[model samples]
Target: MPLFTPEKAQTTDQAKQNCVFMNTKDYDDMVAKCQIKPLYVQLNGVVFLAKPLAECPKDKIMLNANQRKHARISLLSNIQVEPYAPQHSDYTDLVQFAIVPRKALPFDSMNSDLLQKEAISQLIHRTVYDQPLTLEFEQQFFDVTAKSQTLQIVTNTTFFKFSVPHPASKNLQLTGDHVESAVVKDSQLMRFVKQTQESMKQKSDGQEQPTDDDNFELDIEFLGVGGCNKQFADIFRRAFVPRLLPPQIVKQYQMQMVRGLVLYGPPGTGKTLIARKIGEILNAKEPKLVSGPEILNAYVGKSEENIRNLFADAEKEYEEKGDDSELHLIIMDELDAICKQRGSRNDSTGTGDSIVNQLLAKMDGVKQINNVLVIGMTNRLDLMDEALLRPGRFEIQVEIHLPDKVGREQIFRIHTKRFVAKNAFDPEISIEELAELTPNYSGAEIQGVVNAALSYAQTRMMNAQAALEGQQVSLKEFRLLKKDFIRALKEVKAGFGKCDDKQIQLIQQMGFLNSAGTTPIIQDIQNYIQTIRNSSIKLGTVLLHSNSSGTGKSSIAAEIAKTCGIEFVKFISAEALVLKAATEMERCNAIVKAFQDAYKVPEALIILDGIEDIIMYTSEGMRFSNQILTTMLPLLKRGQGRLIVIGTTSKFYGMQALDVTKCFYKQIHVDGLDKTLIDEIVQEWCESRNIKWEGGKASELQCIIDREIVTIRALLQSLEQAASGCNEVQCSDFGKFFENTW
Candidate 1:
């Protein structure tokens, strides 16, 4: 039962006289209104003894049933009080004349806790008064603390001032200033910052600040963490600073920070670097960074013990200090090795199951340790146990995906800054050009490109040194030329198995990226391909459908297979299959042979281009046997791990008549290029051709839509004519090209 005395509506004086409960905050206020003595009050129709204490005791209420510092009074009551507890007692108590509805709400009488789906959202208007007794009288402490009277916050090195509004007023004035340090000294603000710093200190056990590893600042180039400031801001501030915030303020706002976070993504995208930097910023005490192999033992129970030992230090501190425990961060790299889905283990040892259970128990099990943070990094999120990823465990998941064009530019600037600063770099080597060249490169891969260029410069010096055997090599003339970077581009190959620029943007426009919440399309496609390869099911069909020709369906099918890292992708059309055949019978045999040949490869995307033509389809009043249709249907169903048939067709009505729509498992509609993609094509084409496209972007898009469904090929052809030895092509030129071509 709720420990409250429900009361009916009465006068303010009567309400005060009858009220039986109060909190620590309202202890003095309640004392001013009433006498401190043993009294009897009605609780759930039963009478109980209650009293107000002379002092707050043991940080706990002495009148309540349990040894708790605070009581959770229901928000349904309009009145509130802060109850005082005697210092020797362990229980903290506050009794309230809870507003009992004349008719009970449907939510009442269900249970001690409400249902999950139903939540109470109410607007609370509160009043505030300051306690002059709590204020410090010393002037020196006041002088040092005056800076934070106008509160300021920082993000991306820019400071913005903020002020607390009083209950009666809506506005609060503030003054801004530059932030020369992350340190704060004001008494109230220091309560938050100092806690955050100490929590960070727990990772390293308050180790002395290290000497500079290099004279150049990491912020100057942001090495190992290039191009990630914007994305990092949200995760860093939320995870780091919020925990540093005043606990009462945080509770008043109904917000929480998860101690467990996972950073999972592709290889070399800098998940570990981000985790290390975070640990550094938090100043964690002996921050543990372990790879999966380090903990996995051959012995069954030993593996689980290793997992326990990882948290022993932090758990011990939590037990000793309770809420005052320091922050502990454990970064587990390649987490899928041990945390595989609980029952997914095939071994007789059952070690995987034990390891997963041990990790989960440490995270949110019965003990409820709050100071430890587990940061798990993995390339395979799918292979991990489902229970561990849910809320209260590793709930904060962020994907460290490959860099985009702009991100790539920022990365390039960082990687090449050293050479540029020393004036040993080529002026013609544009950072933008290099960024554009490597669309899906990871941070490590981009760093490799810089290494490759340095390697070339070394080779040039070696060759020069060989020419003059006796004299010292001319270090003065050693410089990186534009050709050296061009050479490195060929030798390094930062991005190998990725989609072309156009294909990537096209996929993005098709809402593939919008569907991706934490994983990028690259990972999604790889996972899908792996499923198709490993699953017991035999067949899957992907259809690329468009209403008109030149939709680049064949190109897209091959690109999809390529981006999926499939090496053998075959394109089959009537011309390639039937040119050598002497008769219709021979042509059918050849087509069947090509399909059979495709099945030989371990995972091939066989693109059957011009699907209607492949089926002896004709529109000029000609009829054909349904033998081809029958043979293809069963063949599609029988396809196993080796073959994935992707068929393309401009005509959907023809497929309906043939009754072969069911053969295709997934049909992706290939449509006209959206404006964003159109812009990329136009700008790149004009740039290469040394021609200017003066046509307004909106006008061109509208004009194309106004005319007809514009294929990328047709758009390029039109652009070609407009840029045929012209200084600039205007919107009017597009009209001429559209009219003349279409």
Candidate 2:
């Protein structure tokens, strides 16, 4: 008889306890009619344990809210009071299985293990299906679901999976075969459970286990690496770690394992360190650390043979273990040394091409091995062969960029942790300040800074001992000071923070431009620089031109480059061009090389001082080297890397005639100082240097600015000449000095 009802069950506490009550007579009839005593009621295709309720109506069955929700029914439902029997004859005393909560629970508030054990205890001596089981935790009962299959619990059950929601459900998409072995201790399920429990215990005990989001149970230790948490996360997600699931699970899901990844970035940014650390952290066999140059040989076929030998063990392991093999790691540094774009190699020997072919065959050839993970590190990712960068080869590429301020702080703390723990580091040294000071510093460079600081402290210790003359001195007294770190900054140069000190000195020497006459022009140039910084375009060019010579155009250019905060400030002056190269082609080549070098770094500023002189511009025949002019135009417009070019020239009309003015993003004409501006500059300069300057002969100084195109350069040179001979620079001395100089 149909006995289930669609009506909501009564609110009695007893009905809420995962129990469905049935009428006494109907239950007795069903039990008697069945060949075996009825133990479960099958309602709406779901089975539940049957319990008799004397008060229930004879025509109806009672179900709790949980039962109705699991059943997914609304109206009147029919039920069969059926008996359960084991289908498999070799039923063991114990079964291993995994369970997932049908809904989210506060695992943090409850004893997770106790809840799992309680759920296991309830299924003892009962027939279990691959369906929901009501389990109690902290006096609250909930349904725990498993894979959509059946399992018969004969005597006892052990949970092989628990919370944080298994990765297989999301990452690998587990099938029935993943949980099919409902055997005793020797089953794959039991092995997996044991490994998970061990891993969880290690994590709970405050050990640094491999990142758990991807759920590959391995021990990873990046002892000295810092500022690369995101990169490591990507490696785990897109590389070999995600494929660390059991052989059966992987086979059932038909997922391909990640075999190769490329880690490329600026030198000293920890690409090689990350690769080496990954090799150390994985549970794979010892990694083969071969540099790109190591594969090259003079003999024919030898380089290819060397490449094959690197994969020899992995191939053999795959042959023996098939899909059940342990992982093999191969880390290759300087990968661009051999993998330059195919057919671009200039060598006649063709050794580089053979090495690349051998690597491709080993990584993704016919009958490829599934157990090897190749990690290639290079700073020049653009030089790698395109074929090796596609999917199923070195498919995953992660750029290990230089650490930011926060990452720099982390690297500093990591490097100085032992010193801090030993109380040898200064208590007042603000690490945040150091991080701010060391902009664009790589992890290795940060380590170098720490080492340099230590060297300073050691030097102080030796000096103290030398002064004591064989007297005992406490080692703790030789702690690193704030000044030591400050001094160390000068000693260690970061790869990205490579600035020229001569440019800074020149800017300092050109301090006269801070007067009222030049402030607006300086501010305008600063605005242009800010626009370049905010825009998506990588290249920006500005031209500072004047109608007359000695207008301090080069000084203004140097000041702009120095104060803008770009670490790489290069001055490509005509003197440098002439001194470095004699011929016009050689000079053009030098100019091209300067821009190319700037592209290697993330940001740079190139000051083309005296642009007319560099191009050999002359009034005679309107002649300038067309070769240099052509090279300079494209380089100024080249949109690669974060580059800002400031070109200075006195011959504005000549540049315009040659069409070179169009290459600049902005053009500002610099004007010479007028009479009133010259008076203000002279007064400030005298007060700054403590020289007496009363404008008793101010009218004579006016003649200095009275010329048709008198530049700031001419006025400053006159003042310098007057100051060279006397204790005070008076306005009267300017006329006599100009008479002698001109």
Error of 1 at 581 (Å): 32
- Model 2 has an lDDT value of 0.70
Best by lDDT: 2
What would the TM-scores of all predictions be?
0.45, 0.67
- Whole-model lDDT per candidate: 0.56, 0.70
Mind giving the per-residue lDDT tens digits that candidate 2 earns over 450-554? 889999899888889888996867977879899999999998977656456765566446355577376677778888888887888798888999888777777
In model 1, the runs with Cα more than 4 Å from the true position are 1-223, 250-256, 494-742
Return the TM-score for candidate 2, rounded to 2 decimals: 0.67
Residue 283 of candidate 2: its Cα lDDT? 46
